[model samples]
Every structure is written in structure tokens, then in C-alpha cells.
Target: MSIAQIIGSRHVLAVQNLHASINYYIDQLGFSLVWQIEGWALVQRDSISIMLGECQDDISAHETNNHSYFAYIEVTDIDSLHQEFTHNNVEFVSQLATKDWGQREFAIKTIDGHRIMFGQELLF
Candidate 1:
């Protein structure tokens, strides 16, 4: 089997404020917390999973160095999600717009400067 046939995938993020970040995802955005550990937490929605790794002691040094990459999640409604982020004072970089790839998406910046793009497939 090829790598594309992998059964599961996990997207990890190195967070400076684990509790606050978890709250933003679980409480504000409505993602369910699937698992939690001393310095890690996993939030899930359908096939998407967001893993939070605490960076207090640099146990996950490799992940911390990869903060420049962005995670794009597929959602049913982009506008509603964007509104929730705006209402909660989340630092989003842009409004929902159609991309060259024919997908409607918006970007939100986390506290540690990671850009998460929420995307929806374009019908037209």
C-alpha cells in the first residue's frame, strides 16, 4: 500500500498556551476533545484532528521548529466559522474568498503565529 492509503492522520501544533488554545478550539469553535494528557491535547471533528503540544520545556523541539507551516481544514460552512472567530476576538488574517484552486477558504492566526486555513469546496 502507498502512503496515500494511510488509515489515519494527525495534525500537531506547538502551543505556548495549551489551556487557552484548547479552550479556543473546544469551547469557541465547537471541536470535541478526544484525548488529553499532561502536555498534550487532541481535538477532533469528523476526520479532522488537531493535536496540541505544550512547549513549556521544549520536549517537542522538532514540532516547535515547524511553526511556520499552516493547516488547512475542510469545513461545511466557512462564513459561519469566520464569524465565530471574529466574534470571539480570534486573530484571523483574511475573510472567506474563492481560491485559484476553486476552494473557498479563510485564514486564522493562532497565538503562536500558526495560520490555519478553513476551506470549503466550491460548488460553482
Candidate 2:
């Protein structure tokens, strides 16, 4: 009832370059291509899907660099994830660090410069 009360969550990014975006998402981050259309594709990690679509024709409509949004994903092990990222040569914005919020985390920027923060809960 009432629109199913939000079944799941998803994030979408608009890109001028689709192939490169897909490559970075799939080849680097281990996301799988769930679906693709003429100018759009959906990449999934676990049950979460990120929709990457072609940018609109209007240049003004495109989001500017240094002003993009980032995604924060909760992972089980920060050390393991950091190792994988290092092995893959993924450019991490920062090395793993503990936050005041009781999360151990690191940040990375995708090829398109969208940031991703991988975090784990801090143990006592």
C-alpha cells in the first residue's frame, strides 16, 4: 500500500561518456551491468543499482567538476577493500582513516570524478 513504502534505493549519475563510465564501474569497482539501453546503463553492486545515463544536450545542464556528489557505502572490512583498491590501481582520494562518527573509511574518485566513500563500523 502507498507506493509500496520504498522497496529499495538507487543512485544515478549522468555522464557525457558512457563507455568510460561503465568501464570504471565494472572493470574497476566490480559492479555488474544489469541493463543497458541506447544511452543508459544500470550497474549493480549487491542489490544496489547505479544508473548511468548520457548527459543532456545542454551544456549548462551538466554538473560541474569539483561540485559532484559522492556515495558512501558501508562495507564489512575496510582493510580488505583498501587492499583491493590498491591492487587495482584505483585512485584513492585519501587513505583509510577513522572518523569521529565511529567509522573507519576511505575515499575514491571514479574516472568521471564522482567520489565514493567506503566505510566500516569501528570496533572497540
Candidate 3:
């Protein structure tokens, strides 16, 4: 079987405020702490992981397009995740909607302005 060639991938993000960024990932975004060094941290949510590193300049998620080149999390249940985030007052770049490409998706911004888009495949 030709499975996904990519076994796993981690996005190393630049974070100006390490602790606060860690807190936002852990507390707000529901990611659990994996481990941390003085200037870096690792957090995970299910199968996905992120590496946050302390930096002088953390770039914005988007430079031109409405959204591009950001982390895309393929989840099992998009509606439930959306509801949970909504209840927690998490900011969203857009509401949950099925795109022409046949995936239901939504996007959110992290404390350091990193954008994460969550999606679920449409069987239909």
C-alpha cells in the first residue's frame, strides 16, 4: 500500500515570548507540553507537534494571500473541534465551511500570529 510518504513533520516557529506562547498552545489551543528548553519548547495535540523557539523577530503567518503556507491539521472531527474552540472564545480566521476541494475546514491564529488550519475530509 502506498501510504503517506511523510511520516511526520514539525513546524519550528519563532516566538518572541516563549512562556506566553507555550501557555497559549497548552491552555488555549489544547496542546500538551512535550518538553522545553530555556529558549525552545515542544507541544503536541494528538499526532501533530510544533516546535516553538525564542526569536527576536517572529514573522506573521500570512504575507500576501488570505492564507497560505501555514500548518494544516487533518483532524477526525472538525465540527466538534470548532465547537470547542468557539466555546472557549478562540479567534477564527473563518467559520467552518466545506470548500470546493471537498474538505471542511477552519483557521485560527496563535499568540505569536502563526496561523493553523484544521480540516476533515469529505467522504461524499
For 4-122, candidate 3 gives per-residue lDDT tens digits of 68788888987778898889888888899999998999999898889988985645544425544368889988999999888877889889999999999999877666778999999
In candidate 1 the C-alpha lDDT for residue 38 amounts to: 97
Model 3 CA deviation exceeding 4 Å by range:
1-6, 57-69
RMSD of each: 3.9, 2.7, 3.4
Better of 1 and 3 by TM-score: 3
Tens-digit lDDT string for candidate 2 (1-124): 4565777888988777888889888888889999889999999988768999887563421245555545789998789989988888898888999989999999887777777888999877
List per-prediction Cα lDDT, in the order shown: 0.78, 0.82, 0.84
- In model 2, pairs of residues that clash are none
- Report how far off residue 39 is in candidate 2 (Å): 0.7
- Candidates ranked, most accurate by lDDT first: 3, 2, 1
Weakest 10 consecutive residues of candidate 1 by summed lDDT: 58-67
Q: Model 3 lDDT vs. the true structure? A: 0.84
Instruction: Tally clashing residue pairs in candidate 1.
Output: 0
lDDT (C-alpha) at residue 7 in model 1: 83
